[model samples]
Target chain A: MVMIPPYVPEAFLTMYLPAIYAGLIVGFIGTMAIAMKREEIHILILTDLVGLAMIFIVSAVGTDLAEALILPGLVVELAETLAISEILITREMRKIEQDPRRNLSKSSSLFPQPFSLDMEIMTTAPNFIALVLIGYGIFLTGFTGGAVAGGGIVLYALSKKARGLPVLILDGIAGVSGIAWCLWIIGFLLFFVAPQYWLLSLFLAACGLLLKVASKVGLIGLLMREDIDKE
Target chain B: MEIILIIAIALMVIGAFGIIFLKKPLDKVIMFSILDAGFVLVVVAFKYLDVAMFAALVDPLSTLVFILAIVKINEIRKNKVSGELND
Candidate 1:
């Protein structure tokens, strides 16, 4: 009936969904921090583009369909990334306005604006190394990224209505997948069948919470303001 | 019957708490990374080596990009400093 995991075992993305999710969260948080904090969004943007490039290359390079869909996602991403950047900038501006020490040059704060490469290397490099993989480079690999492939311009567009909602949604989708996958593996370590559906639900829950945060943060309002400010 | 499973599961639970309750930004990053690693450890443990490896690689990439972004935003923030701050 439900066709739950252990009942069927290995339900498509359930296996690698976790990696997709982990990458998405990293990409989402990474980009959001850069967009709002950095003066020059291009540098980190390019680095992320490079990261996406790797995803694109790995997913689409030899596969014809992947190549076909490449431009679609990238084109949408260009506009979407910029839109998200603008919203982030606006929110940062709003936060800055609130600070009583607005005049104090509070250069360093939690996750200070403009990302930290030095710390990234010490802290995040190992995580990124994990993203480069493609499931034994054989059986598990697919034609497109899980998040990207989940839907297309249509779903992305639907999520866009959330106003900065799409990116958050996409990131959640990917991050949760990573978590579920980790659980699946642990299940294996204990000699058990993966609870594929349960894992999916966990990822979906995280995505839902993150979207709620974005909405509450006034991120969408920031987007609206940017569109009207026309500065 | 097993300790490894307990440790792995516990890490995930704790990582979740850290991300939610932590106030410090650096701590948030640390917690997030741990959450990420814990996630990877889980996937790989289940013989989902493919998923595990990718999970391991992505969190860092995400972290690197994140740090770079924060730095860039700070630089821009500094540039935008108003006259009042300068005085």
Candidate 2:
């Protein structure tokens, strides 16, 4: 068996690493300085800039391992943004004596007028585009696949909302996604305890992960529909 | 260094500055998208196609989240101001 050559991490670090670092420094300082003078909302937005800088620095390593490292970073950044945004909204709602949950459940049209869903392409396109995305996501399998698949579902759901579609089966979709999550965990456990069952583990992990991601993302679409629904 | 890499770096730096200096939430989000595009291109330049694909797909969702947050915040501010005026 031919041995795969080990990747030298230093190879890329020596060339143009300084440029990447400069970007990172600028990002960090810029956000910090601006954040000092801004409100919570602006500061929250600025944090995302810091994340971009971190990505630039991390990707400068230019190796497979480094590439893999970037996934966790991205996930953490996304989670941070989501959690912070939720907290900001909830706190603000409560400050005004509004029942946050009630507001979320009842509000329609997050923006002003002309935000209407009357586009001609909304009727013609999203289906094909979402289909292609979901197909590509399946082909990519793993975390990247999940992102692509989730994106497709989100797009499809948004378009459905634009067309005035009702979201009826959200709980069912969430339940199935939970089951897929369990399967994914079992698949990982199997990899460690039953190495001989590699094929079974691989199948479970890949399929379960893909399904879990797609359905969870689809739920985002449904939830957005619920939020934006006027009825 | 390749011309593409240079351009990508420039884009990111410009975006970073724009986000910091631009006071409006909408403008910041727009600049953030520019920064995201540059980051994705840099990943592509480094030949990590998988990571780049993931970045491209997820960036929009993050931007959407930001926009939603900004809108909600603005709405809350409006309600507070109007309520104060009514009182």
Candidate 3:
């Protein structure tokens, strides 16, 4: 008699089989939607949803690196969504502007509705929450948290009133942080050459991650400022 | 738990189709939001509570970003039309 050991326990498979099948079905449908849709926005949305479903399926399967990937995966997904949305919005707007009948009022456009009073109030609320996050991050993670919280504050402020010397200061901070991130990456790579530098490399890597986060948040701030100016 | 996961996945698939098929941008955005909810459900089912919380926090920010982009594009289009009229 020959015996084969199951890598995944039969009990485990039984427990999660339905979820696995469901994820597969959902992913397939999303891909099909993308193949069928001609609209840029529609394709973007379907692709994003499909990507999200794939992540869920991967996580459910208990891949060794799945837990570590969840946060970064969500962040990348949002970044991609932002990029696609920006492209689609720009293209649609250009098309509208070029049209002779683009009567601003009657044009059937995908432009977002104007913000309501409630939304304005909600936008401001992020500032305070970000302040708390900064305090907590700094308390927990030191300089790294400081960078994140600082960047977040700048982002919130810029979104609200992107102008003057403050905006210039934010830009300067972003540039500095970007440089710091690059240096840290170099330090991380050199850690293999000198084992003694491992601790320093790790610290710098954390700094680099935080700086990268700050720079991205600051970019969003600048974008918001530009968006407000366009309005 | 498995049943909940299945339901969430089904909702997500339906939402995805709705987003692709819906003609109105507002309706598509609404469907996107529903898909986001389905994502949260899936995360929760996988017992990644922390991830679910983070998704709850970040998903709305992405939606806000999209909305802002849409508003900005509209403003730019309006400005271009006005500029052409003046010219």
**Residue ranges of candidate 2 with Cα displaced over 4 Å:** A1-6, A9-13, A98-115, A161-168, A228-231, B1-87
The DockQ figures for the candidates are: 0.13, 0.15, 0.12
**lDDT measured at residue A104 in model 2 versus the true structure, 0 to 100:** 42
Ranking by lDDT: 2, 3, 1
Query: 1 or 3: which has the higher lDDT?
Result: 3
Model 3, position A77, has a per-residue lDDT of: 75
DockQ: which is higher, 1 or 3? 1
Q: Rank candidates, TM-score, best first.
A: 2, 3, 1
**Model 3, stretches more than 4 Å misplaced?**
A1-16, A93-127, A137-155, A162-167, A228-231, B1-87
What CAPRI-style quality would you assign to candidate 3? Answer: incorrect
Assess the local accuracy of residue A160 in candidate 3 as a C-alpha lDDT between 0 and 100. 66
TM-scores for every candidate against the unseen true structure: 0.36, 0.67, 0.59
Docking class of 1: incorrect
Candidate 1 vs candidate 3: the TM-score winner is: 3
| Model 1 stretches astray by more than 4 angstroms | A1-231, B78-83
Error of 2 at A168 (Å): 6.5
Better of 1 and 2 by TM-score: 2
List the candidate numbers ranked by DockQ, top first.
2, 1, 3
The candidate scoring highest on TM-score is 2
